[model samples]
Target: MPNHQLLNNMTHHDVKIITDYSTDYGDNISTVMTFPTEFGDIQKEYPIFFRKYPDSEEFQAVVMLGLFQNDNLFLQAGNWQANYIPGAITRGPFAIGFQDQSADGGSEKAPVVHIDMDHPRVNTEKGHPVFLEHGGNSPYLEHISNIFTHMMDGIEVGKTMFAAFKQFDLIEPIELEVTLEGDQVHKLHGNYTVSQTKLNELSAENLQALHRAGFLEAAYLVRSSLSNIQKLVNWQNQKMQQQVTSA
Candidate 1:
C-alpha cells in the first residue's frame, strides 16, 4: 500500500518541507490524506505522483503548473532557458490540480483553490505568459482565460511553467492574511510564524506571499511526476513490443 504519511502531513499543515528521491521520496508525515465514503465506513486514497521532465537534469530546478477542465486535470511544468531574455523574473513554475473537498462539502462548494489562470503574468516576467511546449497534449484552457492566451502562448514557447511555493527568509513570526473558505471563513487563520531560526528571516509581511508561491511550485512537481510516470509506462510497453518482434 502507498504511504499516507506525506499526504496526512500535507493536510495538517498548509506548508511543510519535502524532499524528493527517485527511489524513496521523503516527506515529513507517514499517512496520506483520505476522504470518507458516503457510508462513512471507508476512506479513499488520493492519487499522488511526481512529475517527470524530458531533461532529467532540470527536474529539481523546474516546476509544474496544472489546471482542471472537464473533470480531467491538465498540467504542464517547465522553466525558461538561462539566456532567453533580459531581466527575466527568476520565478517559480505554475501548476494546476483539483480537490473536490470544500469547507461545507455541500452545494455552493468550490475547489480549495481558485487559480488565477487569466492573469497576464504570474511569478514570471512582466510580459511573460504561462504555457506548455509542443508535445504530448495541449494544455486544458478552462483555468486560464482567453484574453491572455495570446500573450501567454507566446511566452510558453520552449518554456513550461509550473506552480510553486517559494522559500523565504524569516526574521520574526508575522500575522498572515490567510483566506479560509471551506467550512468557515476566518479572516485570520492563525498566528503566522516560521520556527526555522537558522535562516535569516524575511519580513513577516512576505511570509504569506512566499507560502503561496511555494505551494504553486510544489503542485507543479506533483503534476510533473504524474506525467513522467505515464510516459515511462508507455515507453516500457513499446520496448517490450520491439524486443518481441525482433525475437
Candidate 2:
C-alpha cells in the first residue's frame, strides 16, 4: 500500500526526493503507463502497447521497458540509459490527488500534489529538495507540478484516443514467443497493439475524423514503435551473455 499524503511546504519543508533511476530505488519496471501526448518521445525508445485496466476493463496505453515483469533493461549501474524517461517514471513519488472544494455554490474536486511517504525516494538527507530553505517550492517541485498537469491532460486525451480506436476495431492481441540462450522459452500474452490492417481499412471519413482528432499520427507512431521489441531482445541477449561469461 502507498502512504500518500498531501504535500505541504510546512510539513514537508525538508523533504528531499531521489531523482536518479536504479533498480534499488524500485525503477525495475517492465512497463510504464503512458498517454498519447507522450507517444512521440516514448515511441523513440519503447514499444507501445495497450492493456486492460484491472478494475474498469478500459484500455490504457503503456510503453514496454522489458520482456518480463521487474526486468527493466534500461537500468545500468543505477542510471537510466534511455534519452527520454516516461513522465510516469520521472514523477517519482509524487502524484496528483484530489481535494474536495466548494466553488460558486457547488462542490467540486480539485487536484492537489501528493507524495508517497514510504517510497524509497522520499528522504530528508539527500537528493533534490522539495522545498527551498525559505519555505518555497523548489525547482524540482515546480517540475513535478508541470509533470502532474501534463499527465492529467494526457489522461483525458488518452481516453478519447482509445475510445476512437476501439470504435474502429483497431486493437488486437499481441502474442510473443521468445527463445533465450540455452533454449529458455518465454511466452507473453494479454497485451494488445494497434492493428495496421484495420487501420488501413478505415473509410476516408473515419480517417479524416481521426486526423482531426490528432490520433492518426499517434497510431502510426505506435505501429512504428513495435520495432523496439528487437532492441529489447538484443539487450536481453547481451545480459545473458554477460552472465554466462561471468559464471
Candidate 3:
C-alpha cells in the first residue's frame, strides 16, 4: 500500500480533474499527472511512483523533473545522469534500471545493473530492456496517475523532481541465463545484489562492506541528485519572481 500522505493536496488545472492512470512496463503501479507548464518549463504536470517498498535496501525508484540548463529536454534517454556511468552500465532518463547480482559472482565482486547495452532498439539504444524483465511489472496506472497529480502539489513549482524508489516486490530480478552472439555469457539474479546477510546477521564487517561498496555511492547519488534538482527549482522560482517584479 502507498502512503497517502505523500499524495495529499495534489491537483491539476486547479479544478477537480480525473487523470489517466497506468503502470510502468514493469507493471509497477504509479500515478501520473500532466499539467500545464510555462514555456520553458519541463512540460505539464508530473508522474510520481508512490509504492512503499517493504525492503528499504534492496530496490528503489524515483521521479525527477525540472528545467535543465544547456537548452535540452532531458527525458528517458540522453540525460546527464543517464550517461554519468555510476561505475558501469549506462542508463537512460525516464526509465527505471536494475543492478542485480550474477549467479556465480557473489554480490561483492560484480554488482551489475541489468540492461541490454546499446543496440538497435527503442529510444536511441539507451540500454533499456525491450520488455520488462519477467518479474518487473509496470507499476499500476492508478499509482502513476495519482502520483503525477500529487506531484504538482507535492513538489514546488520549477523544482527538479527526485524520489528514491524502493519495493522488494516491485523490482525483484528474474533469473535468466543469456548467451550473446560472440559466445558471451550473461546471467541475472536479483537487484540490490549486495548480500544483506551481514545486515541481517548484524555483522559489523558486513555492514562496513556494504558501506564501502555501492551502498555509500547509492546514498551519495540520491543526495546529490536531489541537491541538483533543488537548483532547478530555485532557478525556476527566481525567474518567476523576476517576472512578477517586472510586471
Q: Which candidate wins on lDDT?
A: 2
Residue 26 error, candidate 1, Å:
25
TM-score (C-alpha, index-matched) for candidate 2? 0.96
Model 3 spans > 4 angstroms off: 1-59, 67-206, 211-213, 242-247
What's the residue-level lDDT of 157 in candidate 1? Answer: 24
**Residue 109 of model 1: what lDDT?**
32
- lDDT (0-100) at residue 135 of candidate 3? 30
Scored by CA lDDT, what does every candidate get?
0.26, 0.91, 0.29
Stretches of candidate 2 exceeding 4 Å from the true structure: none
Best by TM-score: 2
Candidate 2, 1-247: lDDT as tens digits: 8999999999999999989888878988898899998899999999999999888869999888998899998887778878999999999998888899988899999999999999999999999999999999999999999988889999999999998888889899989787877788888898999999999999999999989989999999999999998888888888999999999
lDDT of 3: 0.29
Tens digits of per-residue lDDT for model 1 on 158-244? 123222222342212233232222333223211222234422254555545544543323332333333332332333345446667
TM-score of predicted structure 3: 0.25
How close is every model to the real structure, measured as TM-score? 0.18, 0.96, 0.25
Clashes of 3: 39
lDDT for 191 (candidate 1): 21
